[model samples]
Target: MKGVLRFGKVVKLSPRYIGPFEIVERIGKVAYILALPATYIVHNVFHVSSLRKFISKDPSKIITEDVNLQSDLTYVEELDRILEFSVKQLKSRDIPFVKVL
Candidate 1:
């Protein structure tokens, strides 16, 4: 899942559970069939160890936004605005950090 998640410059943070896809049925004692998005070209069936049941606490928190995926399964996050810019002095150099809003 190296290219599974990408957030701006941060690309090493990979999620344990990718989605809360609907379970179509049980394939076997250790396997299950899931209804994944069409954007995913991988197999829908997965092992039970790789699945996690999702329970929504707030129904209004449902995500209805569309995710624009590239051919390589990468999505670009648009930067709204730069809130603040600062520089931190390290041992031998200054590191610049920008806060975006």
Candidate 2:
């Protein structure tokens, strides 16, 4: 589902999709009732635009990486290694820089 409700949290930090929940029933042409978890303190009925079709998961196509995110949804990026180092010749001084991966 599209992340519309923030639930008092930061909207940008919240997940885009909460679940691929089972559809309980169709309310009308553009609304549906989902079988949401008991922990979710919100209405079960949602507009069709807010819902997305669940595609079957493919293990071979999945890519996983170890990422440690902070409380504000930020992560510290560490440089693997410096690829190249160069010094630019200026009129009075030389500026040094390094290219990293």
Candidate 3:
């Protein structure tokens, strides 16, 4: 995963899976080394429980954008579009909120 090792953050907003990297070699029964990109500073070896199989419906649908990371291992997230917008009314105020993609 992208920020799997990052601590003191909200779990729900964290990265689920970063890549579908190729397996380089198997270390033991449950450990395997992956061929990750050079930009990633994490350890190549990982436990089998942390990995997930990638299922692709269409190859052309996959987005291959290059994410530029900062020195702190964070990237700027840009807003694509607003999916929804709504206003909540209270006794004395109205709160506006947006659901974005």
Candidate 4:
């Protein structure tokens, strides 16, 4: 996929699918052009693997959430916890490595 990586900071906390973005058109076989907001400077074309279809079980329903999208279209993420720690072997000695959630 030629598309760039987004939500680097909030990769863990952010929801995987943020939209039912309108599909402008289909590009080739597995690619699509979406009508994303102007804040998203990245290319609109995305591969099929990166896209998810939105389905509504009820005809009349509204979903709401407290999502904050920054000027760059990136959302905020919260830290979960520190899972574990390990020792890293160096040339001179070993050092402590911390893993966070």
Candidate 5:
């Protein structure tokens, strides 16, 4: 079955399982961009960076943060900005060719 992948439709994916975990689908431009928050939970808490490698054969395609330093905070702060940016882009809903990268 087909599904709606947008900020508004995120609710639908919140309570369901996708792959090894439950996730809400989010369509960015061309392909379905996995929800970052959900992805973070699985990535950080569960320790599965394999998804990054799976998404992009070239390491450059995979987005990352610089937490290698001596900072002890939490999740990558950049993800917050990314989600905010993603929401804005989706809301305008005008440019279909805009790339988040």
Candidate 6:
């Protein structure tokens, strides 16, 4: 229940049992990771509930605003569309393999 996940150091939270998520990229001290495109962490996101603020006054906040959901959807859709279009183009051109535009 307690261990360290490191970009370079250790962060100790009771890491919600909700990830075999993959880290796609990392820059600086932060990581960009992805999970199976669903909302899993249904609660306990805000460590700022009234009781928490009462118990510990460190009321810092970061809001992500569904950026991941939007980005993943866009990425998947764009990739699919690109592949389909490439297939059509290749079929029309009768090209055996992709050549420079």
- Candidate closest to the true structure, highest TM-score: 3
Where does candidate 6 have its weakest 10-residue lDDT segment?
A: 45-54
- TM-score (C-alpha, index-matched) for candidate 6: 0.20
Top candidate when judged by lDDT against the true structure: 3
Q: In angstroms, what RMSD does candidate 2 have relative to the true structure?
A: 8.3
Query: Can you give the TM-score per candidate against the true fold?
Result: 0.65, 0.48, 0.70, 0.52, 0.17, 0.20
What tens-digit string does per-residue lDDT give for candidate 2 at 1-98?
35444333445565545546779999879999988655556678888887788776774554434345454434466899999999999999999999
* TM-score between model 1 and native: 0.65
User: lDDT (CA) for every model shown?
Assistant: 0.68, 0.68, 0.74, 0.72, 0.33, 0.30
Residue by residue across 6-56, what tens digits does model 5's lDDT show?
222345434222223223453443333344443232322222322332444
Query: lDDT score of model 6?
Result: 0.30
Q: How many backbone clashes can be found in candidate 4? A: 0
Q: After superposition, how far is residue 29 of candidate 6 from its true place, in Å?
A: 2.7
Regions more than 4 Å wrong, model 6? 1-15, 40-101
What is the C-alpha lDDT profile of model 6 across 34-86, one tens digit per residue? 43335433222222111111223443543233322222222111222222223
The collision pairs in model 5 are: none
| lDDT, residue 54, candidate 6 | 22
Over the stretch 1-101, how does candidate 4's per-residue lDDT look in tens digits? 23545533445564557667779999899999988776655578888997887788984564634456676667666669979989999999999988888
In order of listing, the candidates' clash counts read: 0, 0, 0, 0, 0, 0
Report the C-alpha displacement of residue 68, candidate 1, in angstroms: 2.7
Model 2 TM-score, all chains together: 0.48
Relative to the unseen true structure, what is the C-alpha lDDT of residue 22 in candidate 1, on a scale of 0 to 100? 72
Per-prediction RMSD in angstroms? 4.2, 8.3, 3.9, 6.3, 14.5, 15.9
